[model samples]
Target: MTVASPLRFPDTASAPTMTKRGWWLVVMNILLPGSAQVLAGNRKLGRVGIVATLVLWLLAILTLLTYLIWPSTVYTLFTQTFSLLVVQILLVAYAALWVVLTLDTLRLVRLVKAAPNARAWIAAFSVVVLIGLTCTAGYASVVAGSARGALGDIFSSGPSQPPVDGHYNIMLLGGDAGPDREGLRPDSMSVVSIDAETGQAVTIGLPRDLNPVPFPTDSPLHSLYPDGYGYEDRCDVDVCQLNSIYTEVSLYKPELYPQAEKQHSDPGIESMRDALEGATGLKIQYYVLIDMQGFADLIDSLGGVDVTVSEKLPIGGDENLNGVIDWIEPGKQHLNGYYAQWYARSRHGTSDYDRMARQRQLQDAILKQVNPVNVVSKFQGIADAGTQVVKTDIPQSMLGYFVDLGMKTRKLPVKQLELVPPTIDPANPDYSQIHQLVQEALAPATPTPTSSK
Candidate 1:
């Protein structure tokens, strides 16, 4: 019998086989974490990874379904503090697990045993995948944490408020607290009345100079200014305007809004809310105060805005103290933060009504430009700027509802009624007539009856 050659099996795979194995291991790890270990390396570790991956898949499917069925609930999860914290923790944990599995898969690849030409390729591919996976998960984790911080810093932890008269009326106040100003004064005031069911909205703009603003019968300030806000015989225009309510009440009549502090609000805001409610005949549920000083930062973070400049507007320099430093010329122009701010605020040669129209136009431009892609791309900058720019009494609990309402409002045409000029004299507004106009603007269009054939 021929001397039986001592049967020998190859201890390491052949070059081509090793190359294919290396590629397959990396691919398997990506498609199904821990699968590489089960195929050749550590079975126990691979089983755990497989289980985790399965759980992850199930969770992903469940989350998608929830978002599709009840988007508000999903929004609530992302907005609430406790839920956001939980999400951040889970994201971090998932990121760590992914990193571990990717490393293990690389170890199992045994790149040294691969073909010399294929070794570099396999190693490079694995590294790129590792860095890509690690960075994506890591970035997502950071984003979740940032959102949690922003929500906690920006939104109040107050109780949810109900809509009044089938409408959720929110007061948007643009406060102009310049370096030369004495105190914070709301330069722009608008009540956004949104239909609770349809999300149809009507913006009722109140000029800052509107005098003798009325207060609701239930408001404590009503007793003090029964005739209306700044109704005294020799009332000063600067002190008696609608925007002055905030500073006036906060400084001299804090006692009028005793419950403001408890409700996460200041006396000034409550006073303004009360005055606007009385003026517009709409129950204001929430107030968002935008500091005009920080408005430029917000616009910049959104990559600037496109606005139509009807005439040349001054950028800087006081009209009395010094002439305009620069001018924003007419026609459709893309303006950065500084110019956009001036576009909405320049009052050197323009009337308050002109400024109001520009403000409204700027607002519409922002609404039109703020798509999901822009928001996601510049999320970090926007979040940072938002915290410094906005102050609101809208509670975190109700954010989900508002977000849903906002989405609906975006799809519909926004109706506006500025309390100025021929429509309603801002200098001496007729309270009853203002109420009637508001009703007409908010009323759903009645379908014309079809004529019978």
Candidate 2:
């Protein structure tokens, strides 16, 4: 009876045949990231993909807004909780997601022999997308790896140092360790104090000859010396010197700073930090030790800094030897690496105080020159140069925080103080006066109220 009813069945021959290649599906996936799934019987996944893509775009927009409108909030988050491991994991997950989406799209893209040209175009598009995705992933991985290596090489992992009075103090040391020198001797010493909230910064430059340096009460140096670093024993033959802290600890008194190995990874710098902290009356969280020899290369990588040469600064010279080969003419000059290093370190015809001021000016000029565009353009070269140029105890986990703080600080004018001559006697520095100066330097600037018309 059913056969007698004319065998009514769906017209299978009238239906359009789906070929192996669906070029349009691949194109759809490329455009919308989920449309291929929608057409290939994965509506739920397609919706998820769409939602995820939208969320990602929304997050990007929000991040940009945060950077522009609420930089403080962004800085806080970065300093408090940002981690490189988390960033790397997220990057890997994103790359994996892209790979999955590409594979799924390819699967949906069934080939049609009749539309060979269309298939070829789709294949080409897929190839291009794949290459782009792969290159992007590779680049991200390289950057992450470079950062990880740099951090590991430069910083030590230890308990996070708390800020003092809502300010994080970092001791920057420009070490001049030549072949004849006994050990690393920091010629230039400065304490960089950064306000935790506002990112306002102040640089307190301490002369190299600063003597009778006090030690923190908690430091073993305080216990051993009791009075000062070189009160009982001198560093340079018969005189106590501040620059001697690095060489003395690293070469002469390693046993005294055993904790430095575990905490800071550089006992010399760590000892210097402890002494500087006590002298400055600021809790130094970290130390950035720059090799003076490599300073030129670092500046060169930044395309040379444009500094206003106030006087005829000697170039290519050391403290003891008259290596003055040239003089940077008094004017606004674009100084390359060699000249910039000399500008920062040369004391040929200038006093230590003048050199210090020039060093600070050079620092400011370099900061102005090292903009984001220049940095991005020379990222690889800079990273390579940085490896040899500087060392620090700033942990990788806190790198992002500092980077954000630095960005915030770049907008603010850098305040400077030199502990030289009439300001404060280096040999007999008044501790009370030094502390007061630090307090005043860190004091918040009074806001000028708007004049009501």
Candidate 3:
């Protein structure tokens, strides 16, 4: 037999080898854009991709470090309008760059050279990764845009106010502007005193029927109602209640609060804040007015709230007009927007005081439910509902600070004090006593000393 020359292999890779290499290039591109080009095809494009990838990595690392060291700085960056715009722009740019690099990577892979079976697998994987990454970046960009718009609509552009004393006292008013009612009237009122550093909170619930609503000495209303909000001759329950301050000022005495508009606030809201300051003895820095009718939408956006019901409550009915349409039974219950609104505002058999307590319960439950996962998933819904139903004088600049505080506040138990019967009758409230009680409730807890063994 003639000795044949040793079989010689081709210098170029076989179909199977090329297929494996193609997969490697695609994976490298996914992990680090432009890397595949540097390894195989276009060194220039690859260098640019590598540099961009490194810069993004550096930024991500720095952000992580900053969050660990000075978290508020990160919060401030995200909340600020200019910074948010920059972030949105960067996200869009990066998303585009990723797509470009991915396309270029496929060109470098030369998929046609690979085996038929391997070609399909490679193409499928590249498409999946491309779609997955781009979609994620796109979604994040949308979220940033939504947050920016919502913050602009919901919060004021006014200058940020410092914490009063060691805490921030924010007046929360739940207004009902039903078709039957004349104008927007606050049915629920409370002042939340939040510790500036620790985020501990004390909610002071004021009954809507509280008579003779006092005003600070500096307030214009002080001159009008020197002996409190009611008429001089008679303490009429109909005319003078804590909740009436809003509509009363808005409709009749708009001129009393000329500076209110300049400060990005309404005359009615300023008047209500002034009254709250006088009642609680806490300097109110901001006010949040929530439309009670639209309040259900807000609760629904949060995917519902969890609360323990003390007793059975009717959904919709008045003592005189209608019979009970629905009932929310007692025990730990998960309430949707419709039921949650009724849980807080239903007044058929329950007193205003009962409603006040329920409102506080809902508030606490909502705060607790606002965890990171829930917020991220339902952020758009929440933001949409918030803009429609909520109004506030809390400046946009301070939102980041409050966001951080809210996170801390959710972890701690809230201390509550409702100015109702037994504590102090709302019909005939003693101003001095109310002030004393507020101070006592807001006071820091005293730590007990431990004896060494």
Task: Please write out the lDDT profile of model 3 over residues 218-303, one tens digit for every residue.
Answer: 99999888888874533323477888888888888889999988787889999899999988888999999999999999989999
Full ranking by TM-score = 3, 1, 2
What ranking of all candidate models by lDDT puts the best one first?
3, 1, 2
**Which is better, 1 or 2, measured by TM-score?**
1
Candidate 2 residue runs with Cα over 4 Å from true position: 1-27, 34-130, 223-239, 300-303, 317-327, 369-377, 448-453
> How well does model 3 score by local distance difference test?
0.86
Candidate with better lDDT, 1 vs 2: 1
- Which regions of candidate 1 are displaced past 4 Å? 1-13, 233-238, 320-322, 449-453
TM-score of each: 0.94, 0.76, 0.94
> Model 2: per-residue lDDT, tens digit, 111-159?
4432545556667777798679767766666665665566566665665
lDDT of every predicted structure (CA atoms): 0.83, 0.74, 0.86
Superior by TM-score: candidate 2 or candidate 3 = 3
Query: Who wins the lDDT comparison?
Result: 3
Tens-place lDDT digits, model 1, residues 65-97: 998999888877777888877777877777687
